[model samples]
Target: MAKPRRGVQFQHRGSNHHNGRRPSISESDSVSEPGSPTGAAMNGKLETSKEEDESPPQSEYEKKKQNFITRAIWTLVMMAAFFTAMFSGHLYIIAIITGIQVMSFKEVIAIANVPSRAKNLRFTRSLNWYFLGTTMYFLYGESVIYYFKHIVLVDKVLLPFATHHRFISFMLYVIGFVFFVGSLQKGHYRFQFTQFAWTHMALYLIVVQAHFVMNNIFEGMIWFFLPASLVITNDIFAYICGIAFGRTQLIKLSPKKTVEGFVGAWVCTIFFGFAMTNVLMRYKYFICPVNDLGANIFTGLECTPNPVFIPQAYHIPSIVTDIPLPGSLHIPSIVHVAPMQFHILVFATFASLIAPFGGFFASGLKRTFKVKDFGESIPGHGGITDRMDCQFIMGFFAFMYYQSFIAVYKANVGDVIQTAIQGLDHEEMVEVVKGLSKHLVNQGVVQETVLECWTGVVGNRR
Candidate 1:
């Protein structure tokens, strides 16, 4: 039951590489080191396993199923205290985000296919990483709540995304999962999980930090989809394009991916911008208002201010209104509205572009580690990291962009408001007394006093 020291890599590169496909030192091309029984057996297994490991079969079914299950589990975990946040319902969303952190941490363990170990040192290390991730995730949510209370800022940093919440929630739990796997007390399994969990977490965290900064551009739960949909879409389309018309391979690391596929994915992504934008818009307006953005209260039409109603120089009840004296306040301030659709496009487009890089990064990792697909635990998809790879990467990206482009975008849309008084004619200044008398006859939302003020300063001046 012992594994060979020279474990075969999933993908076979040519002769000089350690990928296990090369001919051995024996006189015969097919044979191994001379008289080395162990080496010969290793050679035979390497030959057979190479033929068997063709990407583990990237399955669309598995992908969609995982997505559904992940979303469902997240929804359930947050239901407990979502309503408990009371008026702070956005806290519920943060709770859900926390759940994502936990699940994602679990996903890393699943991806690396870290075989369970019984050694105490290994078990403890794995548990530590898990706890660290969770602590970070938990702190992230707290940090969000802290800043949500303030007026939006200049430098964006989401402490929740940068915290150890992921470790605390799931990394710590990984040890318990393997300890209960079986009664195999003879050997160790904890160390493998530790290495696996730590490796996966290390890679996924690049994404975690990215999300913490760009949260403004990514809005609502749609922030989740920014990376999700884009990366997944890129994967599917790129594969299809590569299979259909690829003529050139982009790199030796990911030989199957082609230049044709890259172009096709890019072309398709532009369209995704439109579809994804609309999707986020709907989600923001209805499904998930993570920022309390769309929640506007209507004061009713009963006492709505008339657009044309002007105030007089000495209006009624002016003393009680506590109106700022002289140059302190600007009256009749105007509100300028920004187009929501534009913001959506910016978010979706940027997500579509940057999210796919996570997959590329994974491809690079597979090449560097000299492994294929990270692991074979997930069936047809290699491992959890393989499946959730883009989410991890894009999560960081989406969070950062959402904060920058969208939040900063909001800032760029002017806020200072100026209200102006109007005059009636060229002769108005000479008629303040007459204007006051003229104001006495005005009616409706426009008071007689306002009319008197307006006559001196309305139509005549620009």
Candidate 2:
């Protein structure tokens, strides 16, 4: 047979051309077959190129549309959760706020602990968390003491802690500070101290503001609900208005925000705020303070509604109306507007105008860190801090606004009962009743005969 091809000679083993075997092909003469290593690599590259060509990349518009849809769905879910919590009870809302606080703290701490800066530090991470715990304890303790003092003080276990909460909080902080200082290294001092400042700032901004939000809840659900609702409403309207008519950029800090959007949102928010307040004021569940820990939507609560919730008749001024009423005839227009409407307008204004600054501040923070979002905790919504940046500021402002303008001091019977029972022993309580009876008799609020009958009943019980 003709000499076998050099590369194919291996298949004809025993019949050799030289020394019972075919001569090996020279490296220059060898040709790569389709199944060879070089051929397989070329095939793989061709397949990869085909795949890249077949699948088109997503355009910017498509990406934005997908993001918007995702955000809208999650926003609806969040709204559902908020309304469910609002209807559940004040305690449920408090729980939600507390959850938010913890998550926000975690996100902020993660941002502060950059790998390069935190790698050399030994105690920085531990100290940061310790300080967070200490600060949360102090801030949350203050809120509990102020809002739920009755319940806290009456519990024997909680009373001592509640009484010395400030001192205990300070001691806890001091211990952490001492540990932090003791563990400091020569080269890592700057990073450790920077982290220390960052931790406290996060605590103040996140925890302290959130405490005021809880305070707003206790003051009355309306105080919490209306301001929160206004902010949500403003955010929605602002986005809508921005997309529809936005032209001039409002601020450098937030490039997307627009002057038209800002103004339009304010007008729409004011109207929405007024309308929502009108509706919510009619429901005692939405307007009442959480006096009972166990109170819920099912059980309901009863209270003399705040004067703001009560509609008052105001005589219409004749300045705008062409028709003049006779001086003798006092024409009173039966206006069904709540006094809270005026205050809601103020809140709406802030939600539309000033609250956006909080978002701008967050935007600046993200820019400084060169991050797209604070964290990817909320899918399309960025992070909890991003969503709540404006809210904490708004909630704090609502608390201050209520305290300054709208709050009225009304004696609550539950408060009085708690105070009387908290510190008094059985004998002391009996003496208090006796003293109260005599005082009532002296004030003509109780009869001597009634006092005698009460005393006899007490004696029989003993």
Candidate 3:
């Protein structure tokens, strides 16, 4: 610029200057040197890019296969746990059901609890759990009183509670209601009331239905096992059929469901239920009611078999024989089957046709909440409530069905013992014993000498 140098050209290589030419070998080496910070950062980025290029993404089929394998493993584990609890004893089964109820309640409550709604109310969470506890106490107490009336009524300490169980339950509920009302804040009425309603819905759906399930178990393990098995079998077959030949949609509530699956499952469930009943009827442990509360599967129990389990023979009807045969020959048939088999057919029919509505109800609930599952408690199975939806309806139906149609009313030793001791005072009890002894003597069931000795002993005690 000073003199417009003709043959000589001037260049600057400052930190901010650019020559507009490719760098020399020495300059390039300096920029890529391992000791330089810029070189180290570039090297890191290059290695990251290389890794990304080397690793391939998983295909959709592979992902689905992996998920299925995971689900299968977890299902096998759950079944193992379930059968283990079943073989343990009735008490263990009750405990498992109770635990499931609590977990289900927790999941449902969590869904209902919106953070925006729960921000200010202090007692909302506490009140929910309190309601759960009170409801469980009431329902469980009713079951214990009814099933173990003899033992509970005889104990002086527990007598008052047993006698006024319903009143106690009501009073407990009233106390909780008062507490909830008192704790309501000035601006939080709407939120608190919504939570209140939510809590009660959970109680009805999870707890009340679970009470019926407990009753089914005490009535007989068969009542609980058969219905539950039928529902599970139906679910399995429905899924299998749906995948194999499903084309036409069954319902909008569950798009994955197909008409083919629904019909196929019903047919398979009926046959499975009939076959399962035949096998279970052979075991007295499954068919017998829990007479001794203290007895377990290991100690074993003894009871007269329900008449339904006993096989009986019947002749084929004449109407069937009236059918014209090709060769003018008639074949007489005698069928030998248990009465309970026919009863099982009824139960299986209901389980297949009606119980699945419970699943539809759950699906609607999930869609309402914008959730794919109730919770992740069971890996691939969702929450306990999710798995037990149809089971709850099935259990309630089984309990009602047994009480109305199948339950026997024979008086057992516990009934007699309760009537004798609980209905009489001390002196009346002694008199009743003396009268029984005298009656036995007269009937030649005991000797007069032995009766006199027993009477003398009773007199001395008095």
Model 2 Cα displacement at 26 (Å)? 23
Instruction: Quote the lDDT for 331 in model 2.
Output: 44
TM per prediction = 0.43, 0.80, 0.84
Output the number of the TM-score-best candidate: 3
Per-residue lDDT over 1-462 for candidate 3, one digit per residue giving the tens place of the 0 to 100 score: 487766655334444225655566645664659678766776787689889999889989998898788889999998999898887789888999999899999988888688776766777888989999999999999988878887887798988898789999999999999999899888777878888999999999889998999999898888888999999999999999999989999889999999999989999998998899989987777888888656666766677888888989988888886777888597567789888989988898888889999999989988888988888888767888889989888898998888888888878655765687657788887888888889999999989998899888988987
Give the deviation of candidate 2 from the true structure as CA RMSD. 7.8
Regarding lDDT, does 1 or 2 come out ahead?
2
* Clash count for each candidate, listed in order shown: 57, 0, 0
> Which parts of model 1 have CA positions greater than 4 angstroms off?
1-100, 103-123, 126-130, 147-219, 279-354, 367-371, 374-379, 408-462
Error of 3 at 169 (Å): 1.6
Tens digits of per-residue lDDT, candidate 2, 64-137, equal: 99999999999889989988988888889999999999899888878767787676666677777788788888
Off by over 4 Å in 3: 1-49, 53-58, 293-299, 322-331, 413-430, 437-462
Measured by lDDT, the strongest candidate is 3
lDDT, residue 109, candidate 1? 44
Predictions: Cα RMSD each: 22.9, 7.8, 5.8
